[model samples]
Target: MAISTVEATGARVAVVTGGSGGIGSRTAVRLAEDGLAVVVGYTANRDAADAVVTEITANGGAAVAVRVDVADEQAVAAVFDTAEDRFGGVDVVVHAAARMRLSPLADLDLAVLDDMHRTNIRGTFVVARQAARRLRDGGAVITFSSSVVGLAFPEYGAYSASKGAVEALTLILARELRGRNITVNAVAPGPTATELFLQGKDAGTIARLADQPPLRRLGTPADVAEVVAFLAGPGHWINGQVVRANGGIV
Candidate 1:
């Protein structure tokens, strides 16, 4: 496929934060498959990160793994630095590193809320700010949200609140970068079959959720990655939108 308007300035480099495994890892590979040099940023599990890099390299795609703490501006800055030094300027930034703890608001622990926001809200700001200042003339910044924000399910009050903040930041940043030709958007996935989501979930609960979507299946990491790849490569016009890649759950 020919490069879209988002690559007007030759946006061929991508950074995927929290990319050691799960959705982030898949996204890194997907972007690389689109011919972008990928920087896989992971906070821990270097082995997992190395594995991702290996897969991409084995596929003849350029990739490197960088350790990053989404909440640490300096660390995140380093991820961007590595991208420039190793590949070139960043053309796409996918912030997929986040924490989620489920609990009823009535029994929600304040400490848990603090922890989640520190990574979800503050971390998003640190990374998105860098993307805003450093992304090429025409590029994209994709953030992760959850369909629970719309579902209003039990035990998701704090989690959804944090994602709500993500949505707000995503929209405002898109407008803030109005003339830069950069697209800022968020992908809110629902009932994805990821280790993070499956932990502690009973089979009955999982089955119920899988059946809720019109498609009657849990979303795969590849499912959401495809959406991110579109935004990074060809779907340049879908700006400031919170795409519900939730299999019609909403």
Candidate 2:
């Protein structure tokens, strides 16, 4: 069934999954800067999520940290419930929770693939389903993908495949919400300087990727956060698309 946009009553609110660290954390803070109450969702890092909440509160913004396993439907529902309970309503949902495992197609173990699928693909479905059900009219659902889907980097097959599914879900959900005043989009960041990207790479490998982008520098969390803030705010006209936050690597 198509849900129409509802008139928002008070201050806007957002639920950012995986909001404990990296790009998610920065995006949560950025959304708070945009004057929206934020729900910081985390899977295991309670302290990191708490730090994000503290950062927002210290800045005079409102936020809460909720423990949620994105792959679990019931757990995700509770996260949203916390949002609506803490704030007035859910105006935005940022599905930034994903699991990345890099391995060549032949070398990838089935267990690792399953884990990635559970967290990345299933998690996206769970989060987007909840967002579609609960987000108010004029809401924005921003999902995360990776530029590797296009870059076709070696050993990124599994992670890229999962993110490709995310892209598909983003587009389909946008159409499903026909008359709803909400936007569903995915942000595919390139080789950003996030710990996830930097974990196993040496300096040389990092520099090589940084140079692939015309900008000649790795993206910062803040860089991607600006794009998210735009989609959450004035970029309403851009819908059902994958907005790559890459530095022209394509």
Candidate 3:
């Protein structure tokens, strides 16, 4: 599948928030591959966002880069409005926007927890709310969770808490949309080999983390993207579930 094939129809549009970064970037491209016009939303890093747009365009896929902070209602509304105006209406929403703050519960700073909550919990709600409003009746909404929510790692308390909220939101949102044919779900990924995962780790630390997965390897952006594509495209029946793309890592 190529972007050109997607541009041919031009009615299906997908919104991928935080698309300038790891999993979000790959998921945007993969959706384009599956024939959906893509809206790449970013908070910062216009260059990265533009690069994704350029790549899609160069490949003959229709895409645009939109800057919006998903945490703000007005900003998220603007993103949906742009998608409606540019590509007809939203058919898929991949809510990949998130903030990561790692600290043990004993040492966790309240400010850090608050900031993460603002982005992960509030941001997801804002986007999901807009998605609930603007998405076509049969459209799908994909939110991001984390494998740490299962592992209960020591230093991941703040991040895990935010994702826990997301899990709850996904479940209720799917129920709220019942009988509407709209599917809502979350994707929880293990330690993937992205810039975000590399930020605070040495190579040995990264390798040790990778070794923990049953597959004995870290995940790739494409690994998670494939799962997103499935939920957005063929996995419509998988509603209100947190599909883990963690390569068997708990």
Every candidate's lDDT: 0.89, 0.89, 0.89
Lowest lDDT 10-residue stretch of candidate 2: 1-10
TM-score per prediction, in order, is 0.94, 0.95, 0.95
lDDT of 1 by residue, 1-250 (tens): 0111122123399989989888999999999888898888888788899888888877778788888889999999988888786667899999999998999888989999999999999999999999999999888999999999999999889989999999999999999998988999999999999998998899999999999999999999999999989988854579999999999987
lDDT of 1: 0.89
Question: What is the number of residue pairs that collide in model 3?
Answer: 0
TM-score computed on alpha carbons, candidate 3? 0.95
| Residues 149-247 of candidate 3: C-alpha lDDT, one tens digit per residue | 999988998899899999999999999998879889999999999888779889898898899988999999999999999999854579999998988
Query: Which segments of model 3 are wrong by more than 4 Å?
Result: 1-10
Model 1: residue 10 alpha-carbon error in angstroms? 7.6
Q: 201-227 in candidate 2: lDDT tens per residue?
A: 989999899999999999999999999
User: Cα deviation in Å at residue 7, candidate 1?
Assistant: 20
Task: Quickly count the clashes in candidate 1.
Answer: 0
